[model samples]
Target: MEQTETPPPGRRVALAVLGLSAMTIMANATVASSLPGLKRHFADVAGIDTLAGLIVTLPSLAVVITAGLMGWLADRMDRQKLLAFVALCYGLGGTSGLWAESLNAILAGRLLLGVGVAGTMTLGMTWSADLWQGAARARFLGLQGAAISVAGIVFMLTGGALAGLHWRGAFAVYALILPVAVLALLALAPYSRERRRAAPVAKGMARQAGFPWAAFAFVGSLGFVFQAAFYITPTRLPFRLEELGVANPLAVGALMAALVAVSAPVSLAYGRIRRHVSAMSVFGLSFALIGAGFVAHALAQDWHGVLAGSVIAGLGMGLSMPNYTTWFLARVPMAMRGRASGLLTTAFFLGQFASPLVSAPLVAHLGLAGAFGAVGGTLIGLGLLLAVAQIWWPEQARPETAPAAVS
Candidate 1:
């Protein structure tokens, strides 16, 4: 593996790139918050509730279908350029709802937004892995998680606020991606071209590196579980809050923000945590926190208890995401980084897409509180099982060390 002699971009530039990456997650956050507004606007449409719900979830479906193709493209093309193009599409497709005359048209726009998000997110992680390594890589991955958490808070609040005016106002947030596309062009374009020219490894070398099937399966599995659990907050928490007699939308937004707020600081400290604990231990702890948070949510009789539960759950949410990314990056060859990242993205969003399906039945059968209890108990059991596995088969829990040169 030949290292580039050219200095990496400044921290500001790196942050700018990562900031754009954050926008990918915000696609669903704001739109999910605006679902009620959309539902009302399209109330005359048959299956209007389901149709409006798809506006929030359809992008995940797109990502699952297209992320692999986007990842393949990233490996062969100029990633920075691809990022800019996708960002432009993200803005256009995301805001398409504002002008769309019909529910079907809005759904079409969401599908397009999904395409843009797939490319942007897969490429963003691939680019980050390319630019950083070792402890810095861990820290940057943490920052990526932190950035997404912060963006979720901001976007969710903005969506809730805008939903008060009109669902169209919520779509306005998508236009912010246009400026991010410009930033990608200005800050990353030259560097990407430089790296391509300076690279010494042959294309055949990358091809011969071979995919890490076991590692991919392991990470993808974990990604699915983590995402499904984390999504319970966004998909179900608001309604739970409403059931508990906290019906103000802003208060619901505030509580949701609390769930993610702790994630930012916790994610920022992931490097430090990684230094002391094994990856398996980190996963176990993250699951434990999530389980504990959900149990609190199950038991809570008031809003303050919900806030406490969110804070604890947020800690788990923060740790689980970065830990998975760090674990994946550590094992995969650089040549396969994009493809592997795409698979991970697919697994994650597939979980996001499935969360409601898996949990909805439970909600109906058990009621919201019982549903929380069931999920909490399951997560705690998983945490305990993983912890025991770590003790019994520590070697298996650790990431595999890849060859020095991917070729």
Candidate 2:
């Protein structure tokens, strides 16, 4: 028998990774929540309101362009060194909002900020997967999902408080996330690209390397749909509620929070679901529930309709989020993780950025009902493709009887 040493492990690495993951969520959420305040400051500098949302979302475009390239590079380089470099990018890019006086400057800062988010969310996962295995990997993923939710919760709460002090002060809070993420990674060593085994000569390993494509497609499409349905709702809801003679900002915030809150517990419980159900079935169920939520939102005449819809869809996302990421990591060789994940996260972010473009025209032409009705249709299309892909997955994952003859 050939001797193979296990990858590095210690409590320090696990906590560090978890802490890093947790801190990242807060940074992402805080920037988004504090955007309004930042806009007020930048509005004088940039002479724009429509473009304010652009500052926040513009990064996704950059992330889509960069994430895969970086991930592929990570396969051939040191991930921690890359993450450390990006953390500086995060801090510098994030802080630029404080001093940026021109629209162009803000746009440049936004692109950098996008790069930081991409590194933490995508590469961090790859690193952790490289470091852990079996149940621990599953546990860490679950915690990552929960930590992301916690960040959202904390950032929103903190943002509301800090926005009163100054929007710049609010943004300053995001700069802290980069250092914390780096330290946690340094101290904990959560992932293990350093110890990857050589590729085995499996009869169909080359073809097999494509194993996670369908799942990746599903996750990527879902990210875009999530952005469209979840994000567009808040902007549009305020208008729709105005049409109904309700203009209370407090009520709207409460309702939206309730919707997202629905996903947190369900996301944490994902590990339990995996033990009993096939990911294909769960993915289908998630899509169906999300579609139903869209339909409910389309038909909603009152707050109750939207609230009910969000709860249903939140449950779907909560259950499916970590599973999708883990599913991809599990099937690929450690050596290719950076490239593979870069592609996956890029797809996910690209979908997120594309959501508004894809759905806004429909919303404009058809009214909320017609526009959201269109979203349900898109989900059906994605879900159908996934269902078919599921049929082909088992054969692709079968153990290789012989090594591939790669020249």
How do all models score by TM-score?
Answer: 0.92, 0.83
Which lDDT value does model 1 have at 119?
85
Count of steric clashes across candidates, in order: 0, 11
User: In model 2, what lDDT does residue 78 have?
Assistant: 58
> Number of clashing pairs, model 2?
11
lDDT of 1: 0.80
lDDT of 2 by residue, 1-407 (tens): 11132454676776666655655454334666566776666666645777767766777777888887778667665566777877777777777767777667867887887787677666677766666554455556766777677667767777667766776655676677665765665774433333322334321453555545665565666665655555565556566555555578767766667656877888787666666655666666777777777777777788888788778777766766676666666666655666667887776676666666776788779986777777766665666666776777632221111112121
lDDT of candidate 2 at residue 110, scale 0 to 100: 73
Top of the candidates by TM-score: 1
Q: Write the per-residue lDDT of candidate 1 for residues 1-407, one digit (tens) a residue.
A: 33332355687668766877798877687876578777887889999977877888888898899998888877777777778778877877899878989988888888889989988888778777777765566677788889998887778678767877887888988888877777777877776776687445635565566677787787788789888877888778888998899999778888878878999999998877776677788888899899999999999999998999999999998888888777776666676777877888899989999999889999999999999999998999888988997798663322222223241
Q: What is the C-alpha local distance difference test score of candidate 2?
A: 0.65
Off by over 4 Å in 1: 1-8, 198-205, 393-407
